[model samples]
Target: MSIRRLMPGRAALRYGLIGPGTHAQENLLPALSVLDGARLTAVAARRPDAAAEAARRWGADLWTDDWTDLVDGEGTAEIDALIVAGSPQLHADVVPRALARGISVFVEKPPAPDTATLEKLAVDERGAPEGTVAFVGFNFPYGQSYRKLRDTLRAHGTVRTVDLRMVSAKPTSPVWGCATVTDSLLQGLGTHAVDLVLRELGGPDRVTARRADIGTDRHALHVLLEYADGRLATLLLGNYSNRLEYRCELVTDQSVVGVLDDFNTLTLSRPSRTPGVGVLDGKETLRHTWPGRRGGYGRTGYSTELESFHRSVLHGEPSDSPLSACLEVYRVLDEVRRQTGDRP
Candidate 1:
């Protein structure tokens, strides 16, 4: 009873979008042009003018200020899938409703404002119609550099340790109605870091250490994760930097080291010959860089994640970033909040 079988010979799947913000305009909307078997049929935003402008610019046939128009009103009947790129609060409100109607959803990262809301959303997702696909946008794992790193790690032996750092410029104010700058960072940016840890090494047994420097408009956090085994992972997340940077280094038991930089470059260092007693003994390096022209939408995995949602909706395939999978990551995030005394 696959969705594909149910809708025989449908040439293209229609999509409704909520939130025509900068992120959607710059990334998601542009991605629709290259997406096969799909088209943007409608768009809804908080402001009437924004919705109108987005529809005009992106070739969407319908536009409305009230998101309800897409969720349960006029636009709902026209769309097979809904893309939610608004605030986490909006996601909390819209995702469940869309699922109830059997509409597949692709929500941006930080799926909910808090872990409890995300947990509730998971319950709603489970109760959703048989073939509904609920996907969150943890796109880092889908990036080319991270994919290469995963392949390299698989070719090698067990990973002993992982070090991840994600930093970005300070925000002028709290994002998406988060209680504080620190809360916003942990929920928004830190989710990706935690998701990456879970992808590489399963859930950590405990959060060994947690520290944060909370400020009025900027924040920094350091967290250490220890597995039951000897494996370890550390995350340095912050929004007080001069620019955006993302890097991850993985060390394996087979004397292999792989580094993924900024979701575009991967560098691996391995022993070229039998290890000598010296520290810098015979070793060679291999580097792979994504083409600069491919653009961030593809290079950073926005397109890939969207396409995954498309396939899951059309073919009834399980989503790669389902809400259930996010529970563990949020468990770690909840622990971080408790340890750091961050509210909301």
Candidate 2:
């Protein structure tokens, strides 16, 4: 059943905002305004002053500096759900509080800073109200291109191999202001890339990563994930490139599919004849384009993801992104970092 049928529509889903920071103010709040069936009831920041300022500027009904005020105080009941955008450290403390109070949560990525906190969240979620959903915002998963890829793979057959590459200029300002580009790159971009890889390949049994220190706060990483079934996927990620580049190629026995330019493009190619193995020549290529709407931070995809979680919470339906799926990704990150000797 559609999540809408199971819960009160957007209007019924009372939403709140925690951590009224740049991303929340710039992306999430504006996105929430346009998403159907979701309401922005309040906002809370680490500082009461900041929360009050955001509330005044953003039209939120209530504002508090204390996160507990939103989860345990009068404002707590005002919101049936919250989008937790606090720093990575705050997640370990605040997310469980919201869940303990029966409020549904949609956390920003790197849901927690490290493995220990993520593990605790897994346990806390079990005691949450049945059907109370928690989500980690790997917004790319909800992209039209990926949805098509998932659908296509299911309709066609299993993929034999996948190659995904993403290289971009090092993050600027606050992204780099906190940590070296290398540490932040893997934690930030790697999380998104790795999550998508796991989603596409199911899971990787063996993961070996090689890293090169290109510069401060930036490193080039080559990650190879091997599945027990012999399926393999590779990820090339680094903050050293000058241009903004992102693309993924999925190969099946029958056809090769490409998600290019960060899902901005999708192409399909079939070989002229079934070659025994190896790459096909340029002559054996066909392409297909799937046009989709695009706008806003993250292409209006964040709104779609938020709306999905809001509905899931109200109707008592399973979340599109349940905590288990989130935990899987965390486990992957834990394993990868362990192998790479990367710690945050």
Candidate 3:
């Protein structure tokens, strides 16, 4: 079945949300609420009370305990798009069915629990209706600071290396059906790092070296990616920090260095005319910071990602983070999982 295209000045694209958890409440729902191009038509969750509460809070037209109601039941007829903010396993299950019905989808990161399932999703996306989009929510690349860093690197010269570190004080408890804390950490946290690497440096020739400190309470993973031309990228991911943090550094062959701090600030330094001059003492340094009024959703890319997905559905534009693009990230993640023996 082909989806109905929105006529100019018609009603906003109707959206059905599945898995209205904390993440959805804090990020996706709030973002959707503010989008003029999207509407919350329905909400579904594992618990009826939660679903009802979310619908009421978010001003959705309907609520249901079974997610299938939004995908295959009466609610399906009312929705033009689906947002799956569930677990990786649930994302795997829900996305294919939604696409089969000609519904565009915006699924959260780590789209599936494993590479095999993600491959199937890629195939399903290819076979879906021509205009149907299967967008994955890897919002880090949409961050203001990171976007600036990409522009800075491109304008500077050939990129030589990229270093990214993401760490958070996430608990060891398995909240998403992952069997081990290490597995949870990799899927929950490390996928973001991997996706960032792929976006910045493309796929590496190979993962040259990897190290891990997997403990009962704290976990850390370090991966070194090497290119055929001697370029390099390093990923440092951990769940042992006192707070959530993201830091990225990029170096270009033109003696330009860019640093992004916590998705809010970007600093770029160009080589000075005089030799052996430090950036601190040089004149060619530039800094940009996200405005405080934009809020966390804008700084962290959630709002931009959600808005982009909505625009794609309304205008027949290609998804920025389509399922096909996500497969490469999963391939790299699969390799990391194998090397670290962090299978669930």
Candidate 4:
């Protein structure tokens, strides 16, 4: 059944904002402006001045320095949900509080800085009423190109190999919520790729970790995941690259699918018969162009993801999908740390 049938078509899901910082301002708010399923009800930042200005700018009805006020529902709008866009510590605190109140939550990635906190969230969520939405923002695979690429890989036989490469430029200013990642770079940036790899091919049986120092405060990582079924994936990540670079490659016995240029391109390759066939006969070459990739950040499934969560809440659909997936990402990060003994 289409879950949209459960919601009033005209009613928007009202959601408050906690930790209204740069991410909220740039990504979430801009995306919300173009989507109709959700609307901003309030915004809360660590500083009252910042919150007040943000509320004015974002069109929220109220603003506060203390996020708990929204959780308490005192002098605030009767919100149906909240988008927790702050650091890991704030997410650990507000997410549970909001959920315990039966308010749905949309928290940014690295849901918690540690496994213990995630386990606690699991406990809290179990006690909440069924259909209470809990979503984690791992927004990569949601991109149209990536989605198409993932779906295409499903029919290409068993996955033999997978590669994820991402190199990000250093931040020019403080990135909100970054301070809370256990190992900020890997947890923050690497989470998306980790989540995607596991989602596409099922869980790995075992993984070996590796890394090399590239520069001051910069490093390159190599983690190899081996599945019992003989599937393997290599995650290549680095922050030293001054320019942006992101790509994902999935290879099967008969096909090779690539998500390149930070999702700007999707290239497919498959076996082709060679002309001089004396029995040696074929080579895999670039073949198809999967056509759903969008042009910019706003178009790249950010709004679509928000709309999805809002619709799920109003329609009583299972948002539990992201919750468990999010935990698996943490598990991957945890295992990498265990294997490499890199404590951040």
TM-score of each: 0.92, 0.85, 0.91, 0.86
lDDT of 4 by residue, 127-152 (tens): 77777888887677676667777676
> lDDT of all predictions, in order shown?
0.85, 0.74, 0.85, 0.72
Each prediction's number of clashing residue pairs: 0, 8, 0, 0
Clashes in model 1: which pairs? none
Which candidate do you rate higher for TM-score, 1 or 4? Answer: 1
Per-residue lDDT of 264 in model 4: 66
lDDT of 1 at 103: 89
What are the runs in model 1 whose C-alpha is more than 4 Å off?
A: 1-11, 212-216, 272-281
Candidate 2 residue lDDT tens string, 1-344: 65565564546777788888887887778878777767777888877789889888876789887788888998977888888887777776778888887888998887877667788888888888776778877777776666666565554456878888878886632352234455567677788888888887787888888788764556788889898988999999887778757788888756655454566666655555654333444455434454444554444267667777877887788778766676677777667676766655
How does candidate 3 fare on TM-score? Answer: 0.91
Query: Which residue pairs in candidate 3 have backbone atoms (N, alpha carbon, C) closer than 3 angstroms, thus clashing?
Result: none
C-alpha RMSD of each candidate structure in angstroms:
5.6, 5.8, 5.5, 6.1
Candidate 1, poorest ten consecutive residues by summed lDDT: 274-283
Residue pairs with clashing backbones, model 2 = 6-315, 7-315, 10-37, 48-65, 180-217, 181-217, 182-217, 182-218
Q: Between candidates 1 and 4, which one is better according to lDDT?
A: 1
